[model samples]
Target: MAVNPPKIKVLLSANERLQKLKEAFHGKYKESPLFYACAPGRVNLIGEHIDYCGYAVLPMAIEQNILAAVSVNSSQTIQLANTDPKYKDFTVSVNEITIDRENPQWHYYFLCGVKGVQEQLGLSSMTGISCVVDGTIPASSGLSSSSALVCCAGLVTMEANQKTISKVLLAETCAKCERYIGTEGGGMDQSISFLAEEGTAKLIEFNPLRATDVKLPEGAVFVIANSCVEMNKAASSHFNIRVVECRIATKVLAKARGLEWSSLQKLGDLQTALGLSLEKMLDLVEEVLHPEPYSREEICKILGITTEQLSKNILSANTHHNLICRPCVS
Candidate 1:
């Protein structure tokens, strides 16, 4: 007999505020006949800062996710509420694409997703809706809690319209929406959340949509440690700076080799265009961008970087430390 997939219960909590909000909303919106959808947060196991470059990423959807209750309105305005104490009531009109830094704070991220879907579908106006969001993931540990919110909002909106949506299209729309929020993160998080199967991890390659299943090691427990650090790139410009730097590096290398950088679709393509091995390409990236220290010195020289600058640059990148990538071992 074929076994049914095990049921997973998602817990909603923002340090205890979510429970109260859930109860309050359940009472207030109970008679409204709202529709609900969920999208989970993700943990990237490998390939950090490499997804935009067309490298493979290993990511898994966690049990924690954002549960959204949505009800359509007659007007073309979107209203949002978060179960957390930090977030307050916010409203937006579909015709306007403005970011509000102050009030109705939680809606900003979800609105980006809506904007992305709208732009992709060429819709002049979106169905006005009110959404109540409840999240279970940690705030800023790099587990992609923000992406989850965007995707869940998009899913809720699409379902409310009774539209048939594909998982791939939803993932792409969510990824595009994230760009509106001013973060140039890869599409790995949204893609993984939509595509990942329970009890398995996925290796995702962005261009052309290549995904492979990666079996989790037996008896292994995946633990996400909260660092109590809330770093959002929207407020600080550091994340944008890194994105610009990467673009610059790609352009420079492409010019040096007499090729158009835009034509280079994958990280592998960039490596081939530059005529550099994986180790050499990584070393070159480290030498110029200097995001982190070289785990090995011999690898640095092979890519044409002096040892003196390597250590200093790597140490500098370590100060903002939150989540470190741990390699998957056999």
Candidate 2:
């Protein structure tokens, strides 16, 4: 039997939070929003950083989300407002949309989603939108508030333009577009946000991303508690550094296995090429990689590649601060 996917509906009348958001939007814009789009924040239960290495991650949708009240019109500009007073209102001409990565303002993340959808659909001109964003996810909580906002915006844009796309397509597009704001994500957040079904967690895998329902133990309750300490993964280079380290590890391991190392860019790709189980992959990491860091010169010599090829083909935009690749560890 074909299973039914979870239904996501706009039930403002039944949801107090959504109702307040709608009222607030109507008060600001003087008209009721035509429709609403929402994307929930996700909690990664396991396989956190490994997702970028093209591994499967276990994540579940939380109650907190980013909700947008939207209306399509012929205003020729996009207007944005937030329910929270701290975030000031922003507006931009549809013809001249721009996102600034350095500032990382609240609205710029919203634009990342808008611009992503616009480019994906290849719309010469977009329907102008007046949107009010209301978010329950705490910012910088490691719970994917920014990604939820981006996903929500992508949904809003698609709806405003009267376009229809599959959840997988929307998830993939939103994942790629979020990098415009300097985040090197692995699609875990967007995938879980769109693919999550009520009453079950999901195992989200990438490289032709798909989600499978995971049954939880009976009587188990998952609770999310904020540490109150915030880390913006995009604002810092630590996340990218880890990604580059993994990429380097993949190439090195491929070379050790007599595979064409240059073509391999992810740990998961290497794992697939070797046809090894996860346990075997972990064993291989220990057998081939050293605890000490590898310099670029040593890596080049080991891989039989020149320094120029290493820089041109392997290094990421932010990984050039040093020539050392960190030790590989699970």
Candidate 3:
């Protein structure tokens, strides 16, 4: 049985935006869009960069989002056009979708989501699509614009294939597929984007992957200011380096406690094994993992794994450049 997504109520303002998107799609594709998919950008008010380590994140979807108007085609080719002229149009065969990490274009991010849903549904070939993507989120401003794009693409693909999926399932699939673009995120962005309810924030937890609504204080107004600078997390090695640091720290902590640490990839897994709270986990980090940077040889000695195994298993492509890993406890 095909599961249905949660009922979404579009307000007058959102309806106007959809109408504009529909008109834009017709202008570009010379045909009306069958349906529109939207995924909002997110703001992580408290948690930062810990989601990939299997930690809970408190996030909320912002008003800005990536919206896509799509129509299915019989051309066996996926055609993409952007409402923004800066992003050039792209078309590819249904069976040939390639996401380039080196030169990460706007279209490649959309393809990441489409390819993700395609792979998740086990479809060897996908139906051709004509899509016009529009977004208001500031690119690379740490507000999950890329993740929103991926989520939007995933939804478009699912609807185009005539498959129904729950918001939770779509969020999970989109999160996993985002790794195709070389950013190993913790899934909070996509989760809140899909699972968010209007007028409330969400406490997004991982591993089991659930969300609980968090009410805000009455009359509290939050403001977000962009620095007008951009950092592509996938293009840079900084984000992955932190992930590697945490992994090494987990293995070292696990090895110290006399628990088999090889299988422990997440700090949350270590916390579960020790039955420790977040405070206790911080205490454990100070006790076991030192502040000094750990070299490749030192980490290998502690984990009893060779340098080759370390590179293959623990370190990602970006982390290989930095052999000295620091435990980012503070």
The parts of candidate 1 lying over 4 Å away from their true place are: 1-22, 26-30, 100-104, 261-269, 272-276, 280-330
Q: After superposing candidate 3, which stretches have Cα over 4 Å from the reference?
A: 1-3, 6-16
Clash total of candidate 1: 1
- lDDT score for candidate 1 against the true structure: 0.66
> What is the C-alpha local distance difference test score of each model?
0.66, 0.86, 0.86
Per-prediction tally of clashes: 1, 0, 0
For each candidate in turn, the TM-score is 0.75, 0.91, 0.94
Model 2, runs deviating above 4 Å: 1-13, 300-312, 322-327
lDDT, candidate 2, 1-330, per-residue tens:
022223367566888987998899899999999988889999989897988889999999999999899888999899999999999999999899887876778888889998998999898999999999999999999999999999999998888888877888889889999888878888999889889878889999887888899988899998888889988876767777787788889988988899998888889999999999989999999999988878889988888888888777877555666666674844
What ordering of candidates by lDDT runs from best to worst? 3, 2, 1
Worst window of 10 by summed lDDT in candidate 3: 1-10
Q: Write the per-residue lDDT of candidate 1 for residues 1-330, one digit (tens) a residue.
A: 012112244465643544555565666556343556778888889887677666788999998888776778778888777777687778778788675533224578888777777777677767788778888888655778888888887777676555656777778778877766666666888888778787889989766665688999998898888788886655555554454444435643554456765444345567767788888876765554434422334323433455554333321232223221211110
Q: How far is candidate 1 from the true structure (C-alpha RMSD, Å)?
A: 8.5
